[model samples]
Target: MSTIFGIPTPALYGQILIGLINGSFYALLSLGLAVIFGLLRVINFAHGAQYMLGAFVAYLLLNYLGINYWLALIVAPLVVGAVAVVIERTMLSRLYGVDHLYGLLLTFGLALILEGAFRHWFGAAGQPYAAPSQLSGGVNLGFMFLPIYRGWVVVASLVICIGTWLLIEKTQLGAYLRAATENATLVQAFGVNVPLLLTLTYGLGAALAAFAGVLAAPIYQVSPLMGTNLIIVVFAVVVVGGMGSILGAIITGYVLGILEGLTKVFYPEASSIVIFVIMAIVLLVRPAGLFGREE
Candidate 1:
């Protein structure tokens, strides 16, 4: 077995593929955080819970309602997003005039409540959710075998990330979002329903997180704690990429994922902590983050 840097070539490729898959999830979750923070200026802590909710929703739909994965993919996000709209309307909207910490605490509480409720109902163990029939195979790429479902995840995440970027940076509605972020009062004066936009933005962000959860369902066990475990790392990705930077979030996610994978290959001990180490370094060097603009 030929080795590269004392690591087997096969192992390296395998880790890279795994990294890409993980990167897809990171990109998606961070992108949603960026979008919501960019527009609402509120750090949404319940994002992870919402993500867990999405996976659970898919699991329920498939097992009980006979809903297929394809339909669950579309419906789960909508359900979670609608729930988010209600949260924003009933709870988050009131904190707009108060300190940002209030919003953070509120969302954090919401996250706890969601996770605890699910755990009570489902227990701590993860449930099984099979991939769709069409995606149940592998493609042998000479040096490595790639799972079709994982490849699909990567492709789908890329499409969603790019499409979201275009929607926020190119379209007319995107312009309104950016404008409102800068000056909500002024935009409201122009007859734009800024409050509705805020509600919709929250929903969209929640939907994005839910979509990532759906993509992740087949890859990982559908556990109540899954989102809680991943959220910290995703937050690190967001910070390293820079807060409120969509493109930055996307790029940083994939990059760090690869880095983490390589670390696992070379220094397995540091694999878990590599991202956080990088986050600390990035903050020390650039407080505004890699892609964030300084105030």
Candidate 2:
């Protein structure tokens, strides 16, 4: 059994893989956050709850309606995203032009409400969600065993991240979005319907969160609290990556994920705090985040 830094090779590789998996989730979630914050200027504290909702929706569809994972993957996000649109239209839309803190508080309250409601209905226990039959197996690499579902997660996350980047950076619609973010009054004068754009952006962000939750259903127990724990780490990733920089969020997520994995191998005790420690360093060095422009 060959060892790297006194750790068994298999163990080391396994941890790295786990890190990559985690990184994928972080990237997806943080990307959504960046999109919302960048344009809407609303820090969506309900994002985690929206994510939990996605998993719960998937679970309900599968257990009650006989909808399979494949269908749930498509339906769950749309359902949650539509709900997000309603929330934005009826409630969040009113908070515009006010203090950003008001938006944060509103979303935080929404998150608590959602979590409490789910807890009341489902209790605190985690529900089991099996991976699809096609993704239930593993491939034995010479050095390590790779689970197909996890590999799929990494690939899917990368694809989504890249596609979103292209949409925001290279497309005409993206140009319109950027323009609205910069000068909404000017865009509105040009007949761009800025309010609709804001609502859609928020909906898209929530959908991204829910999509990640669906991906996570098989790996983690689908519980009301699942997104609660991960959201904090994701916020840290956002701060380190720069809140509005799409590419920065994606890159930072994977980098920090691998760093956390390596930390687990080298110093187990610091693994949990590694991301935050880096976050603190990044803050001190660049208060606007690694990619954010200084205000």
Error of 1 at 27 (Å): 0.7
Lowest lDDT 10-mer window, candidate 1? Answer: 238-247
- Candidate 1, clashing residue pairs? none
Model 1: per-residue Cα lDDT over 44-63, one tens digit each: 88989999999999999999
Give the TM-scores of the predictions, in the order they appear: 0.98, 0.98
Error of 1 at 22 (Å): 1.1
Q: Report the Cα lDDT for residue 66, model 1.
A: 100
Give Cα-based local distance difference scores for all models: 0.93, 0.92
Off by over 4 Å in 1: none
Error of 2 at 19 (Å): 0.7
lDDT of 2 by residue, 22-57 (tens): 999899999999999988899999999999999999
